[model samples]
Target: MTDQAIIKTGGKQYRVAVGDKLRIEKLTADVGANVDFAEVLFVGAGADARIGTPLVEGAKVNAVVRSHGRGKKLIVYKFRRRKNYRRKNGHRQPYTEVEITGISA
Candidate 1:
């Protein structure tokens, strides 16, 4: 009966609530596809909260994939003083945008 929950995906954890939109690690799901996050760590808040030892059993959060995109590029610069060793690189992490539809706990 809670409105908020914590979910784990792609080695990361996110706090979400119904109708929330989030960008997370890339998934294979296409746009408008349904995705379920079963690794719920906690649900609810205050006195009504439920905390799982590792993951809550029978708890899940449903979402719909809205889009797929990459995050802003990050500059990775490596340099060594007096060693003439310098490297510059850029990275853009792929992510999936999803909207939380419902949470069952």
Candidate 2:
């Protein structure tokens, strides 16, 4: 029953609370699917927080997938000043939008 918790996903960690909306790396769940994050690193509010050695045992985060989409395109360019070499590329990373529904610890 903490106000916030830190959960890990997609090789990254995020501090989140109930009702928070965030975009995370692409997930396999379909839109509107429920997802649970079990790799909780920390939980609780303020001084009451509990931090895990690597991951907290018996801690989890519940969320609902809002959507799946690609992020804004990013342009990558490479050039050689005197070699007349030029290269350009664009990339869009896929992501999942989710809303924090609840946390259990």
Candidate 3:
């Protein structure tokens, strides 16, 4: 059986395995904290397996918080061709990086 699994976090789903590094939306966990996600929307072994109606019970994804940081800054600009209206702005999104330790099904 494969050790890979699909789990949901921060309103998004990710396919992960042990030792995989992934970046998701901003999480409240501090660095070196352990986080477990129990909401498993899908589970499979090889090419065939069981699927949950909503979520599979007893499924979990364990991970460790590696770091907290901000993503690349994005510039937002708006201009009007005929009018003299212009606007420019920059935004940096907060994010968290985590390492998958284990996935159980």
User: Could you tally the backbone clashes for each prediction?
Assistant: 0, 0, 0
lDDT rank, highest first?
1, 2, 3
Clashes of 2: 0
Q: Candidate 2: list runs displaced more than 4 Å.
A: none
Residue 68 displacement (Å), model 3: 0.6
- Model 3 residue 40 lDDT? 85
**lDDT of residue 6 for candidate 3:** 82
What is the lDDT for 60 in model 3? 87
As for model 1, its CA RMSD to the true structure in angstroms is 1.4
Inter-residue clash pairs, candidate 2: none
Per-residue alpha-carbon lDDT of candidate 3 for residues 4-97, written as tens digits (9 for 90 to 100)? 7788888899988789999999999999999998988777776666577789889888999999999999999999999999999999998999
- TM values, all candidates: 0.94, 0.94, 0.89
**Cα deviation of 25, candidate 3, in Å:** 0.6
Tens-place lDDT per residue, model 1, 19-86, is: 99999999999999999999999988889888999988899999999999999999999999999999
Query: Which model scores highest in lDDT?
Result: 1
Report the C-alpha displacement of residue 48, candidate 1, in angstroms: 2.3
